[model samples]
Target: MTTQLITPTQSAYAYPLLIKHLLNTPLIYSPDQEIVYRDCFRYDYKTLGKRIKQLASMLKAQGVKPGDTIAVMDWDSHRYLECFFAVPMMGAVLHTVNIRLTSEQLIYTINHAEDDIILVNEEFLPLLESVKDRFETVKKVIVLSDKGAIPASSIEFSGEYEALVSDAVPEYTFPDFDENTMATTFYTTGTTGLPKGVFFSHRQIVLHTYGVMAGLTAYKSQANISSADVYMPMTPMFHVHAWGMPYLMTLLGAKQVYPGRYEPETLLKLIVGEQVTYSHCVPTIMNMLITSPSIKDVDLKGWKVIIGGSALSKGLCKEALGHGINLFTGYGMSETCPILTLSNLKPHMLEWGEDEQVEIRCKTGLPIPEVQLEVVDVEGNPVAHDGQTPGEVVTRTPWLTQGYVKSGEQSEELWKDGWLHTGDIGVIDQEGYLRITDRLKDVIKTGGEWISSLELEDIISQHEAVNEVAVVGITDEKWGERPMAMVVLKEEFQGKISEKDIQEFCMTFVEKGQIPKYGVPGKIVLDAVIPKTSVGKISKKDIRGTYGENLN
Candidate 1:
């Protein structure tokens, strides 16, 4: 059968899906809607539109041409949001510099991306000063400061961010270009070696924003977001564009508050003062917010948060529920534009009690709109959807990165067998819930059996004394590998519970036939904290590197 095709009028306008169009709805519908940055700055969408033009003019005056890379090193602020649109709309690539990477990795990304201009926060001046000589392609630097003060530095300054925007012509028009033009590039440290760069087109980003919007609002779950809800982002703007929420929220014309630098007190204050109703962050940030002394003083009853970047432990889900913060899991990686699934409950599941819902909330979740996900065995065949058998997760999505920038070999491996290999071990239930068990590299292979580190971590996290926990396999002579736990206890219980106590707690689970007896950690190391990646996931890689050899 042949498919029918339709032809449009010769004079009909062929609109392209560009980032600039995202601005139009907001400017027309919510022109006066406020976009706030900490306690200092606040402005409306109309002004934001003008400022975007001003920023583009400023960059143009500084010789930023289409295809040039413009990098930003500021915290999550209105300025960063401005760049998110203005740079791409101008046909240049936006490089969101990961401020958390080590100095070497940071310099490598800046150089690797061939950034032509960098809008850097004033606080990071010393970092650039110490390594400016190493930068290979950075041609200019614009200072971003809350006080509008441009401090002295060894590197030649292009200008202060606001001053340049204020002086540049605001009437310059944004030209239309191919929707497939490269719009943004950011390095992801999800892989080994140096960071791998992921590039996305304007069309891909637009579709992704729509995909996330539909996924969040279409469901009847507690985490649904609407235009009436106040939105703030707890994730760093540099990480997958804060899971691409800025674009989604902007398109909705929702009120936005950007908390600069993520100070606990400031985050809590903004939430209460602005009545922030919707936000997203890693589990670590949620843990920090709940454990903070200021949290008790603030009211968080109606706030809705989505926890991603790592698994949402059932213990954390229960703890957050007690504080009246609505929480759920979102799953993805940098390679996937960072949003493949969200743990939004189905209509029927909403009738279940909180305890029953927590189980669903902690699963990796159902795939978001336009995402085709599957758990495949070693041979690339689909696994049973019984939720017991584990397999590697792979996906096909409109927004997945086409390839890693400039690295042919790595890109091939990433898209092997025509699917984007997630390198994650996961399972799908009969009801379509996907639960990630472990990273393929992090899974423990011990004495002819497999033990999931995530499962062990979940069990340990439920203990009353446990504040944070990470379980990794250490080399063992008899078992080939054995589980080891590095734990951090709550302040009140730091001195009360010992390592032996945690081992006994896991043994109780073993007695219930929850985990196998051998699954208990052979050694438990209580510490002040567990190591975390730049995006706040538990750093099991670092843990194993530090203790893998000596612990056994």
Candidate 2:
């Protein structure tokens, strides 16, 4: 006898109902509080959302269709936040261009995405102007600035951002868009090669938002969060949607504080005065904040932080715990709707001691609900749950990007058998916790075994003298490839340490065989500070590009 498969009644049409029902709910809430933008102006969210809707109305009037892509270039600000919602909710795709990218790469992404209009901040206008002629698809330019006049050189836009919104009706209706309609497009950071685009639909973003709120994921509760909680995202808006916190904050109805350009002092002051209860940034940014001279005088007792965009160092995690701040680590990528796993404590782990709990919280974490994650070998076989054997991490989620935009190479490898290969080497514990051991490309192969550069970096960063560190493989004739440590020492101990000290420390972790003789970095390059990506992880790509070729 053949068995019949049954589908749940709610599974067939749950998305549209949720979207339409939640439309008029209090999606955004900001208290009557002051948010100092660059130590200057202050604005509330009621005003912010009004401006957002006005901008949405303006975009609608300008012939922006549902599928059109509107690219934005600006620092973190109320206006930037406005574009985050207005463009997407209006059914136009918001393409946040990475301002730190090279001019050529910037031109390449813009032309490739075919952005219909470019909304640029005044400070970035000159950079845009340098490649203005190269953007063949952009028909209009909307300047976002306090300056009164549009520059004479460029063609007149419909109007300046503020004026255009002021003239438009704020009450314009947001169209009923299908959940599957394109909502936003962001290009990958592309550590190795050209940037590729990833687009998210309304359904994906909405589901991602819900997944973020679930207690098993980030465990963000509106009850725990209030209108009083001030949010300052240290991550830039241009990178991986700032890990999607801006939208999440809006959805949670929290008061958001925007730091236009990240200055450690500015951020610290906002946290103290604004009583910032929650924030999100990468490990490097957290390092900068805690180590900065300004932090000594600041009171950060109630601050809760979420660390992502890269691995969180044990050193940084310890420092955060010391400050009486609640810190949690998560993992994701630009292709995975930016959040796949978050380190929330499991039910059984709650009985463990505080120290034991922190260790688990430091891992990459369990896959968020609706996301399925696996550690697979070279042939895609699932690795054991013993947590000792390492394998390539792969996943499937509703929010993950279908594939890179306009790129054909390795597309098959990226989404083979309907799962996204993360290229991260990791293992899953019996408790289902995932700990990323290394990036597949960055893993050191010596004596026919894999060495995790991430593991070594985490250990080296624990030294009091080390400020930041990155480990990359240097080609070796004998071992094929060996690990090299590029370090940035704490300011006070710059010349006081040697490469031998770092090597000696690694020897204590394991025997010579367990930690390969060649696994220790052959050379250590000392720098004033390690270069970092926009989201604040140490940029090993930059280090390898600068120094790897020199190694034999």
Candidate 3:
């Protein structure tokens, strides 16, 4: 078929879709929409544009060049937003360092990414100083202080962040580059080993942004985001670009509020003060907000939040809805540009009752546009979309990561048969919605039955006394593995609720056919809190390691 080839005329020109181009429409249209950083400062999109250019100028002045990696460790702030644009726009890769990682893993990610320089928030200076000697590529340290003057540090400062931007020329041009140029890189919070690096190109990010916008708006969604939407990111910016909401908001020129740090009181204040209309986070944050005394008297009506990074429990969903907050589920991971599915209701489905709506909204969701998703058996055959046939969810999308950086074996495993294996076991409904049952490793195979730990967690979290829950499979001789639950009780319910009560609760679900009898955990260990991964998902692997041994 290629034997006859023809070239296009010179009249045709190709325009690459780089990250810098995302700022063009906003600068032209909504130049005055404010980007607020808590109560500390506020700037319009015009100034955001200017600051981004200045930031680029400053980085260039500091020896950053195309393809160099500039890392940032800070809270979700205006400065982070500027770097989100400026660093990538200048053709230098942005490495959003995860402060939640341990000192060792933190050093590993920075070294693996080959970051040439790091911009550290004052609070993290001690972390930098502890590992600066072990850094493989770091050459400069720039301090970022939101408060008063930064204290003296053992590690010498290359330049203060604010000063660098202030001193630089604001007129530096961002040259266009190939759309496939690597734009940003970050490490995934893996369970079994050190973090894995995943990166995206300029074209992938832009497409993901538009795809998310389309997915949110293409249906009847209370959480639909647009220019009128006031945006706040509850997810950490260091994690999957805060599910990439920052770029979508900027592209739409929406009013943005960056809560410097996530405190319950501070978040409530900003939600009320800024009228934050839309946000996204894991279920833990939702639990915190709903239970916090600060939000008790606050009217959270009209606040739409998309829950991801973990499953949304029905109890949590009902609680958020009771407060008149529009809550739903979104499904993605650090690998798929962090978003491939969102559980927005169809137009006809909107008339369904609230219970049905919550049920639908909590599923893994339908795939967004340009995303090809499938539930496949071990042999790579497609499963029947009957809502009961469980299989691994594999997908093909333009925005998915090329592969794990420098890990060829894992990368090959990720893209076997030309589809990106998600390592997620799920079932697709006849209506085309995906319900993720469990991670491939987290599923309990007991007495020749597969039990979903997420299912158990969801069922137990409905108890009035339960605050949070995690279910993990513990090793056993008779059964290959048995489920054990670690629970966190509400303060008032502590020491009052017994393990038997939870067991009896599970019995009720078994009776109702919600879960099988074997799916119930043999024990429920009550605690003050459940440990979480760096990105806020419940750390089931840690729980298994702690309790799964010597359970005789």
Q: What C-alpha lDDT values do all the predictions have?
A: 0.92, 0.77, 0.90
Candidate 3 lDDT over 1-552, as tens digits, reads 569766968897678988888899998889999999989889999999999989989999899999999999999999999999999998999999999888899999999999999999999887888898898898888999876355699988887888888889999888878999999999997777889999999999999998998998766655577799999999999998999999999999999999988898999999999999999999998889888988877999999899998999988898899999999989998999889988888777888899899889899898999999999999999999999999999999889998999999999999999999999999999989999999998999988998999999899988988888999899888787889999888889989999999999999999998888988888778873578888788888788778867456
Better of 1 and 2 by lDDT: 1
Could you tell which candidate, 1 or 2, scores higher by TM-score?
1
How far off is residue 311 in model 1, in Å?
0.8
Regions of model 3 farther than 4 Å from truth: 1-6
Cα lDDT tens digits for candidate 2, 1-552: 999987768756443612322324343333443444655557765666567778888988888987789999988877777787788777788899998877888898899999999998878876888898787899888888766456654645657887787898877667665778777887777676777888887788778877766733245421134444667888888887788777666665666788888889989988887777888888878888888999899888878788887788777777778887778788998888888987877666667775786787689987878889999998999989898988999998888887778776667768987779999999999888899999887888876878889888888777878888888887777777778888888889988888888788777765745566666777777754577775567788887777665356
What local lDDT does model 2 show for residue 406?
Answer: 76
Full ranking by TM-score: 1, 3, 2
Worst 10 residues of 1 by lDDT: 543-552
Error of 1 at 78 (Å): 0.4
Q: Please report the candidate that would top lDDT against the real structure.
A: 1
**What stretches of model 1 exceed 4 Å from their correct place?**
1-8, 550-552
Q: Which of the two candidates, 1 or 3, achieves a greater lDDT against the reference?
A: 1
| Model 3 clashing-pair count | 0
lDDT of 3: 0.90
Residue 452 shift from truth in candidate 2, angstroms: 0.4
Off-target runs (Cα >4 Å) in candidate 2 are 1-23, 27-45, 147-157, 216-228, 347-355, 511-514, 549-552
